[model samples]
Target: MPVARGTKAQSTKQPRASKAPSVTENVPPQKDEGCQAKRSPSSPQGGPKKRSAFGDITNAHKNQAVTGKKEGVKAPTNKATRAPTAPTVAKNNEINLKKSLKKTPPAEVPVEHEKDSVPEEPVQQVPVVEDIDKEQLGDPYANAEYAKEIFDYMREREDKFLLPDYMEKQPDISRDMRAILVDWMVEVQENFELNHETLYLAVKLVDHYLVEVASMRDKLQLIGSTAVLIASKFEERCPPCVDDFLYICDDAYKREELIAMETSILRTLNFDINIPIPYRFLRRFAKCARASMETLTLARFLCEMTLQEYDYVRERPSKLAASSLLLALIMKNLGGWTPTLEYYSGYCAQDLHPLVKRLNFLLTYQPCDKLKAVRTKYSHRVFFEVAKMTPMDMMKLEEKLKS
Candidate 1:
């Protein structure tokens, strides 16, 4: 203790150890943390500084700090040397992402609401007509189903109001006699090129009047023949005389009686002489098909033949006409079928065969071979039925026809 002596270790360690104290203790804890975290005016530094965190530091400051010298340093008085600011673009992008996530989608438009908003205007929808060939339309006969419905309706109505027994018991005529009458009448329609509807109308009138009013004991043949006589005058330009009808009826009806009954029948029909026939429809359908005259003729023949069948008489006039025409065309080997008939029938392609079979059966069962001459003379067979008379009665009718 008398003399201050310098050790070799103490001298060397003194400067190095002293430098550590200044460097480690001189930096303020709060300020250092603020400088690294973010540059802000409200930080522990107490004043706004423009320098960024990334801004370069002066070489003099670095040297002084490394030497542990605090000659001019005052707790980093140049706070302007602040850390670089974070990217503003990055912060803004993050805010925008949050906003988008909270946004709602637009609502959908409703059909009814949109429709109500539109202006009011009438919309014209055109009817779609099938573009069938002219020939196909020439035959107007439709399906038998419609015909059946019509006939069924009529028959049911008739059954409800059965005629008097006196009227039902009208003179019986044999199948041959009826056939003979019908044949002649069919010829008459053909010769004059008369409408088949007229014939059907005449037959309908006869059947109705005979069942409802005419005495059963009276010759039913007379009533039938007279109904035709009246119908012909209404339908044809050239009507036959009462004598002509008498001749056709084989003298079964007198001129006075025929005239009287004709008046009665006319009254019953309400003078509605314009009976619609399938022939006109047949022509239309055949035209649609572009069919030959022979084809049309055959279709017409079929339509006329359909008239004799009890089913056709009961059917809708149009449908009966269409079916008949189709059957005729099929029989004649004419192709190019129109769907018009099928549409009316509400049938598929498969249903046509059964309809045809029914038609054929009806036609086959109703023979006209024996009535050829008589029907030709009358242009109508209103009172003829092959099944209604016996062979002896037929002979008498034949004898009368010859007379």
Candidate 2:
């Protein structure tokens, strides 16, 4: 051993050959034997961990016990100790948060139900009467072999012709203005002897046109007369000439104006005029009710009156026609919507109750001083003077319905 002048002498003793580590050795340095993990008999030095036949749980217990007894042994001091249960508690909290999210209810979505998904909120329907016999209902149809099939075909397709929210969209023109137009068109239809389909389709075309274009209130009549001309061409084998429409409008509109308005309507509607109407439903329901020509005329009179109603335009045509026929039945002292009517009309009396009240009001409604054409026209003889029959204690009837 050498000693430097300013430094202390080095120790003469060297590490023993068996205790010193070689330069390339991988084995860990020696530790207290009593605190080390117990070695298994089959495990060679520096090999894989020895595990119990059952599981690692036995080794975990042994490690815990040995670590508890080795408090004197130094472990790394850098780690911060946490509560023994902190990890498990944090995991439980995370699980609870996930469960709360899963249990939270979501908003309801709208879906169309097959079995008449229409709202129960007083749909334009008629009232159900007490029990009555079906045998007493006289069958007036020439043939009703497949009337139900025809009703279903049209009813299924009625949704296509649904007009936009015109009352909301056409804010410039009031509903009263529309009422005046319809009242005047009724006279025109009667004067020209147009088919009832022509009138219904004409009204529908005018609504669709008004929905697409933002016309001033003054142009509303021109729109209506133009729609009538268009519908006549569609429904009549020989449609009225443009000049005839001018005569109906009292030449308030020139032929060129009518023609231009017709082009605008066809463009607005995309020329798609094969729309369903209340008249078709009326015919089908009349045949199903086995109604007399007088009864059909009365129902037609009631249905025609509704065209003047702005709110009623939103109603399904089938519903409107059913309401009218049901009212006519009660007025005529016939049963209140027998099952045969239900089977053919595809509507129960309850389905018509809301609409029935509306029609009753319309029937009993007195037009404003300026509007008397509907009242005056239906009061005539050819229409069976149904406008006069509208006063029959529409409120009172011996309503007897059969199951």
Best by TM-score: 2
- For residues 123-157, write the lDDT of model 2, one tens digit per residue: 54644432222443455563244444665777887
- The residue-by-residue lDDT of candidate 1 on 1-403, one tens digit each, is 1111222333321222223224334543222222222423343433222232113112112212221123224435454233212232223223333332233122211433345445533332322334444334445585433543553454344443332333234455433343444455566555545666556666656545655453543455676667667667777787777777777667766778877877777687666545444455555556545667655554454555554444444444445555555555555545424465454334333444445445545544545454334323323333223223222233332333233
Candidate achieving the largest lDDT: 2
Q: Each model's C-alpha lDDT? A: 0.46, 0.66
Q: What TM-score would candidate 2 get against the native?
A: 0.61
Model 2 C-alpha lDDT versus the unseen true structure: 0.66
Candidate 2 displacement at residue 240 in angstroms: 1.0
- Report how far off residue 369 is in candidate 1 (Å): 5.8
